[model samples]
Target: MSTTDVLVVGAGPAGLACAATVLEHSDLSVVVLDAGHGPGGQYWRQPAPASGPGALDGAELADLHHDRGTFVELVRRVEQGRAEGRLEIRSEQHVWSVVPDGERYAAHTVDRSGGPGREAGSTTRARAVLVATGAYDRALPFPGWDLPGVMTVGGLQALLKAGGVRAGQRVAIGGTGPFLLPVAAGLARRGSTIVGVYEANRPGGWLREGRAVVRNPAKLGEGAGYAATMLRHRVPVRTGRMIVSAHGTDRVEAVTVARLDRAGHPVPGSEQRVAVDAVGVGWGFTPQLDLAVTLGVDLTTDLAGTPVVGVDDLQRTSRPRVYAAGEVCGVGGAALAVAEGRLAAAGIVADLSAHGMPGASVARDRREVARLRAFADAILRAHPVPAGWADRLEDDTILCRCEEVRCATVRSAIDELGATDARQVKQLTRTGMGWCQGRVCGYAAALLSSGRPGPAVERLISAPVPLGALAAQPTSEPHVE
Candidate 1:
């Protein structure tokens, strides 16, 4: 087992920024552990050598907008540190659990081969841990959502960023948030015939948050650029509408789009069927907080209806010696993530400075954090989840696809089976025991099973253990003597 002064648990912007900053000032060693083969998280993903641009799907194309240069430089810095024997970058490693022991912590991880591949796997210990595991695109299932061609907006972006692929020749990008516009336009630019853009909120909804956007001119300009691209492609942006259902025999061949009322409920006679090969849909992001929550960090509900690790101005959590940044704190975009990461590193440095090491330039880093946080707040307030979103779901429809648990089963688990918490519901109905280990289905399960209470909700929920632990362990075979 190896040990380091600080261990950053993700290769995303937040993790990398923290690692780079720590390496800049102190003799304290830093190590980065990530499951991705490359430095980029889902956003700045790069293709494997065997993977080609043609292999990219619609989702992959959308990830191209990520600032690859920043990630590249991070990898370069890590490599330099490695050459100097000051950094250890463990790629394709999936961390299972992080348990605190005294002033240090132990992190368990398996090799990328998921235990079956021919690789050495081991665990490591660190003095302090930085959780930068980014958020996941929430999967809200509708009728026919289980069809093969349906995917989340983030999934499409991952395919493109990692493999230079697109989802299909004809595709529809439908969802809420500023993420979809760029995703749709990116896919369209890559030769995909985007059928329509369906958004649950109307244009006027954004007007309510105009002051927020005005405060962040760069964000405004970014949105304007995405809008301009969609306009150029004539993609027919439909606001206040949502995909009620996707219809197809083998794969998604058509979708039923409907205009919603002010309450975001479907309006009668407003439904229209549009033929399409694929539909990329998502409501928004939810923090990937299994590690943070598992470590007993205090979790709070954000405006996006997700649980994020609560942190102070220094990014320190309720747990001493633990810090969080990036989407783990909330679903702020990469710029905000980078800003938080830098501030977190500075904070760590300051805490370590009592030993005579000069910490990160405090005044400068605070200014950077303040600027980015203002922008993040603006973005969050502008994109609050529409009310009564669960109203769009049908009872028989699947809510947790990982375990084939339907909404009806979830309702039964709560209403009939006396299941008061997400764990009990999952135990009774297998709602969150899927491949993703409840990352995809946990939020929906909690909300459907209960009213999704705040700190109380956390008590009711039992997040799945990281699946990386269950990989087949290689053992010494018996000698046939």
Candidate 2:
């Protein structure tokens, strides 16, 4: 197995920033592992490589991304580090587990570079580990949500940003949060006929968070740009409305939109049917903490009741030699993620080297993180998941699509089977025992049984691994740095 001084577990904004910082500030050798085919993670997803036909170049893809200058600079710095032989980035490498190996850690990975049937397993040992696994879309269940052509807003944006492919000719977007605006604007720019943008929360809620808005003027400018795009495309945004059901024989053809009352319930006789070929919905995001959980790092909940890795001002976790940044710490935006990543690298440099990070620099980054995170908290408070979302689910609504578990089954598990939490419900009704291993349905299951999101169930294996790859793993001890 190979060894390095620092191993970063993502290649997104946070991971790229961390690796670049470590190389610039200290003599530490850094290695980055990511599951994506290239860098930028989900926020700055890139197009296919230029080697392929019809591939979009950097100039062509820049319009699809926000803060392109920052991404470009980070990528250039990372490339320079790679050229200098101080950093190595292994793309398409899925790090499934990280276990303690003496004073260091061993990260097991399944390489998907060769695609199907050629998967290989490998291990890397490092003295320090940083996890920047990022977050995934938070989806809520509605009637016909499982139907084809219905997906999360993030998935829709991924298609447009990664390949410039519009998902459908006519689309209906629904959710709570400002995220809906950008997705709708992007799709509309790509020639999709946006039927309507349904937002469950009113924009006036932002008036209450005046201090946060003043602290982050760039956010207001960004919001205004998206508003201009929507106005240019004539995309109608309806406030205090939600899509309660999608209807179709085979795929999504139409959606039933309902006005929400103050209690977040559907207003009687206020439903309208909107025709659309596709529907995109999102509540918010859930921090991806699988790797952090496996590392046994201290955990805490965020404003949305989602579990996040606990970290100090310098981004050091409770576990020694382990650090966490970006969405794994909390669901802040990319700017906050970059700041946290640089801070984590600074912490690593101070711990590994004789001279520590400059007091002024560290304090500056800490203040930046606090400002951006405050804006994030304001966003969460403004666009919270509707209190009565589960009240809209029908008895036949599927909770876990992989296991075919329905709403009625979950209720039965809670009422008749003495299941008080998501864990017990998983055991009694098999709600979270499907192929996804609770990634998709865990939130809904937890909220159904308990009033809040529950702790994630840790697994030895984070992702599905080929049996042959597992069989081929080396039994020898990893070389410690």
Candidate 3:
């Protein structure tokens, strides 16, 4: 087993920033393990490597990302730290569990970098552990949502960013929040015909949070740029509208768009049929808390009522020597994540080093986090999940695609089986006892039964592992710092 002064569980903006800060502020050794093949996480995901070396260049993928400069700088610092032997990064390593070992923590990981003679499972013990696992796309169910061409907006973005592939020639983007804008704009730029951009919430709600809007001028500029792109591509940006249902035989060939009432229900007379080969939908994000829950960290709800890891201003979790940053704290953007990460690193430095982080730097990062988080709250308020979303579910609509649990089964569990929460529903109807372990269907299930998002389900294994890997785990105790 390997040991380190600090172990970061992600290489996203938050993890990268935290590693860089720790290296610059202290002499401690750091190791970063990420499931991604490289750094940048989902926000700045790079394209897959070309068949030959130097075939794909940064210039080719530049337009696919936002805030490239920040990603570049963080990567540079991480590379420098690795070169000087102050840091190590294990890419394509999925850390499944973290357990308390005396005064330290032991992280169990499975190597996912498929190749010849790869170690299946291993453990690394660290003095301090920081989880920046980030969030994933939260999708709600509707008729034909399980169709072949239906996908989350994040998935569509991933396809374009990671593989330079457009989801379809004709794409209809539907969702709430500012995310749809960028996805629509990117696909439009990539030579896809955007049928329309359907947003369930009206942007006028931002007027209520005028102070936050003024505080983040950069966000406004970003929005303005996307607006320009939409106008340039002639992509229709319709507010107070949502895609109620997708329609097709074997794949999605059209969608039903409906204007939403004040209560977020669809207006019966306002439905319109739009033709599209691909449909992308989203309802904000759910913070990834699998490892955090396993570590027994405190949990709380964010502004959107999504469960997130609870942390102090310095990003310290309830568990001693444990910290969490980025979307795990809340579903803010990358800038806020970076601030929180740097702050978490500062907390670690203060706790572990003889010389703690400078007061001025800590204070500055705190202020930045506060400002960015406020803007994030504003965004959440502006784009809440439509209250009547579940009301539109048909009896045959698939709720859990993995197990083919339909809306009727879920409703039966709730109304007839005395299931008041997702857990009870799962026990009664097998709603979440599938391969995904409720990651995709948990949010919708909770909302349907309990009227709120469910708590993160605790699991010893965060991701699926090969049985051979489990058998190959070493019996020796991991060395502690």
- Estimate, for each residue in 356-456, the C-alpha lDDT of model 3 and write its tens digit: 99999999999999999999999999899989787678999999989899999999998888899999988887887999888789889999889999878
For each candidate, C-alpha RMSD in Å? Answer: 5.2, 1.8, 1.9
Q: For model 2, which pairs clash? A: none
Give the per-residue lDDT digits (tens) of candidate 2, residues 309-330.
Answer: 9999889999899999999998
- Stretches off by above 4 angstroms in model 1 are 51-63, 113-116, 353-361, 414-421, 453-481
Global lDDT of each model?
Answer: 0.75, 0.90, 0.91
TM-score computed on alpha carbons, candidate 3: 0.97
State the weakest 10-residue window (summed lDDT) of model 1: 453-462
Which segments of candidate 2 are over 4 A away from where they belong? Answer: 50-52, 477-481
**Deviation from truth (RMSD, Å), model 3:** 1.9
TM-score of each: 0.88, 0.97, 0.97
Residue 420 accuracy (lDDT) in model 1: 79
For model 2 the local lDDT of residue 286 reads: 88
